[model samples]
Target: MVDGESEAADIVEHYELDYDESGRITRGYQQLELVRTREIVGRHLPPGPLQVLDVGGGTGAHARWLAEAGHQVLLVDLVPRHVQAARALAEEGLSVRAELGDARQLDIADESFDAVLLLGPLYHLTDRGDRVRALREAGRVAKPGCLVFAAAISRFASLFDGLARGFLFDPAFRSIVERDLAEGQHRNPDRHPGWFTTAYLHHPDELMSEAAEARLRTVEIVGVEGLCAWLPQLAEQWEDPERREVILESIRAVESEACLRALSPHLLLIARRPG
Candidate 1:
């Protein structure tokens, strides 16, 4: 309904989020999120020739990974450009299909896939009702078993994140912060044609509460990156081997604590349809 996915949507779309040259998607707080997600969905299922609906999955990163690993993957995004980009990646024969679609209205049959991944949509949708609708749609297309979602937390974590990693921000983000503080919530200027995406910070409780409404039971909730995201400068410094490994262990250790979870840059939750 709204243009672009939301603020969160723009963040993912605008950035190059794939694993770096080192072959990892995240570190520190996010380690647990990725670890737990892969563990639950990875171990529980039979070899994934399984059907997977990767909603709001930009650029088919996860879709390509899963598809190449032997699952049938469908990656959808709201932006036409995203679809084209993913399609280009799929041309290499990864058993992945990319389509342009909205998360609030998924054109999928009931119980169609073994898993549904809503990792991006929740961040952009600030309204509780709208987010719940997206969750309901995710539940609609998924069979009763495993589904996972990810969201970015609210700015309250900004204090920790700003301190831990140093929140060197994009010039675009300043306006967003001003609008959010003043108007309760606001969108940044349009980034591209018909694409009005920006960040929408979230309360962790809101995420859990919304999932509850959709009848999706919470399994595991973790952050994508805790203090590490704040330290983009340090992250760049980790180009060497020793520093990277040290960081890997250091961040992985704290990924589970309640305090660390609260301040994570992106929050990831793995939920399932109740039996």
Candidate 2:
């Protein structure tokens, strides 16, 4: 757990620490697992060969898919279980590699890859500075013009979750809520000792600001199943390919609509590092 970051200990304890059937790859994280594998990969890669790094993308969902698509993928995560599981999966003929690490730091050299996928770190880092640090780490390893897609939760959604879950008034939780409201950005994801994990609710502008702070340029801000995260049965309702496409289109349809995009539950921003 990082000292300056909140929820580090709580989150680490809550995660499957060793990847023994925690179900994120197949259970609760199911929605994001698919949304990311499909939408995220396409957003970063060109038709030809490209190098990609999946930062905190557990289970190698995006990495494995991209590898099979003939691209080079390196899956990096702090959780050892996630990395081991991803590596085991990669062994079955996917051009994917897994490494255990913190999202705010990379073992590789600077400008080592074409694109970086930061789908998990943004939602978990409590401090804005920590978030910036993670973004900077990504930028450090990616080449100029490199594509980077990062995920963030909507601000209102955080309060909704807190109040709805009865943690809105807790002392630790209140601190984060007040911070985000004041900053017009990220709220707290602080958690109790265990039983659950901390997750931030965010704003599009806050994410954009962080990207700019890290010297990254925004390209596309894609919302992956934002409205549907609360709608448990929606993804299951997509019975056929046509219906699935329709559902996905509807979710993506409001991608740029200001009024709609702001409140979307989850936001995936396609950003680039300037040369």
Off by over 4 Å in 2: 5-7, 17-29, 158-196, 232-236
Ten contiguous residues with the weakest lDDT in model 2: 187-196
Model 2 misses residue 237 by how many Å? 1.7
Model 1 agreement with the true structure over 134-232: per-residue lDDT tens digits: 898998888877675555555454444434533315444445555554432545455532213454566566678888898889876666555665665
Candidate 2, residues 2-91, lDDT tens digits: the string is: 454345654555566422434544444354436644765585577757888889877776676678778888988877777788898666
lDDT scores for all predictions?
0.64, 0.71
How far out, in Å, is residue 73 in model 1? 0.4
Clashing pairs in 2: 153-202, 154-202, 155-202
Over 4 Å off, model 1: 1-46, 157-186, 189-197
Task: State the lDDT at 273 in candidate 1.
Answer: 81
